[model samples]
Target: MLTPYNLPQDMCMKSHFIFLTLICPGPKDPGKKIDIYLQPLIEEMEELWAIGTPTYDVSTDQMFVMKVAIIWTISDFHAYDMLSGWSTHDLMGCPICMEKSGANWLTFSGKLSYFDCHRKFLPPKH
Candidate 1:
């Protein structure tokens, strides 16, 4: 079911300023392959964003530059993990649990459940 797909996209600021845009192909699954594919784009984005943006202050009639430290992107679960370098499997994979023991599976009403611990390694705050 996992196949490679490509689409052109753009990044916008406050629904006005369009910053970056590109067309790229990637696999449907979130794994090492997708991580490899995203590296170049990530590097390019970092380099461009490091330059910051110039802004004009009307009160002082002066220009200042603002640097952005973070970029938020929306994607599907698999794509999100691929872009963010997160694992989709058990043991430090569950975004809510963050468990590293790899023994978090439990049977609940005749069904296997993840992120549900049977043993008390730690309290469940998630």
Candidate 2:
């Protein structure tokens, strides 16, 4: 299980705490896909969804009802690589706008970065 750790004492805790809740599991090592490994968990989640929530009521016929709305809050990389079946480093990284990004070299780190430059109110129609 991935967890957020305490940062330096001098650093502000507000924004850091916000980042803590956004943590998720993904490809730990290079050249390995996590989809197969996550299958069991996904199956379990499906089972749970099938079971639904058990509620007590005299008039109710069934104990479980299918009233679940699964919200998968994940990082952009995971959204691209795992959920959307797209390569993060490719042209279709952003699921919303589907805008292709170019090599954006950072002056400080001297690293190539490709960030989605487009903005949209809603995701594009499939």
lDDT of 1 by residue, 53-88 (tens): 686867789998754444356667566676667775
Off by over 4 Å in 1: 1-23, 26-31, 35-41, 48-53, 71-76, 100-112, 115-126
Candidates in order have lDDT scores of 0.54, 0.51
TM-score of each: 0.45, 0.42
CA lDDT, candidate 2, residue 83: 51
Give the per-residue lDDT digits (tens) of candidate 2, residues 83-122: 5566766455455435544436678987656644443333
Each candidate: how many clashes?
0, 0
lDDT of model 1 at position 78: 69
The global Cα lDDT (0 to 1) of model 2 is: 0.51
For candidate 1, the clash count comes to 0
Error of 2 at 119 (Å): 11
